[model samples]
Target: MGVIPALVILYFTIKGYEDYFKDKKIFLSFVAGLLAGFFSVLFESFVRNAGVVSLIVLIPFFEQIVKTSILNSRLARGTEGAPIYGATLGLGFGSIFIPFSMVIYASRWSGLDIVGLSIVTLGAIGFIFFHGATGIYIGYGVKSDRVW
Candidate 1:
């Protein structure tokens, strides 16, 4: 369900910055982000017993960390394109996050109507941006030699 929107956003966003990257670095970073997203989902599954607070806290913490792992890629080395690549990676992570969370919370799933659905959509968008912004921050940090 969420995959289409995620990919749509990812495609438009990355396409705009494609000129900044060389070879397949941008694509590689996105793939790495997808891997990070899958890894986070699998990792989260094994730790679901930690309770709700952890779901709101620890899981996201770990995820942001993992999503940023793309920053370590050879394609992400240059400062000029780091943030763009980072955002791509982050959006890629967002691509999997919705399906991942839907599965994790399936037992508790409930349909929401207009208002509730709107809120959920907004929240998802915000979180996707959260991933992108954090990626940008870390990527920028690396570019600035802060050693992200």
Candidate 2:
């Protein structure tokens, strides 16, 4: 991913964290949820063997659910913080994936033309934004009592 994409992701993440800090209890829960969500995959060999599609859907689902629960629970008090919480989760998750993505992209396309590089940059930005949006929606839903 290009620097611009990375920055955008970072911006959202920071925003999410700021929201969570509005309630320290909720914020701590979010941190715990994120860590648990992030590490949950490591202990599950079965999911890995379930194939690529399952792995792709399951891991993110698990993380989002856990985070949403934590963030949403705080909404009964107020929803003012949902956006930040969501953005933070997205940013955190994206940060973890981006470096590896950059390495793989650079290695494979290092010799490609500028057009190829541009494609990679765009893809990265799109992916990060998509992830950020997902977080935002999920958190917002939970906080607003619109959905869970």
- lDDT against the true structure, each candidate: 0.70, 0.56
lDDT leader: 1
Lowest-scoring 10 consecutive residues by lDDT in candidate 2? 25-34
- What TM value does model 2 have? 0.54
Tens digits of per-residue lDDT, candidate 2, 1-148, equal 3334545555546653554455554445345434643464343345767788767888667766665665566543256566666655554444444444455577866775677666766665665566567767776675666742
Runs in model 2 lying further than 4 Å from the true structure:
1-49, 73-77, 104-121, 145-148
Question: Which predicted model would earn the best TM-score?
Answer: 1
Please provide, for model 1 over 17-122, each residue's C-alpha lDDT reduced to its tens digit, 9 standing for 90 to 100: 6677654776777778778877887888877688998889989889877755558656676568887778777876766766655444444656445675566566
Question: 34, model 1: CA deviation in Å?
Answer: 1.5
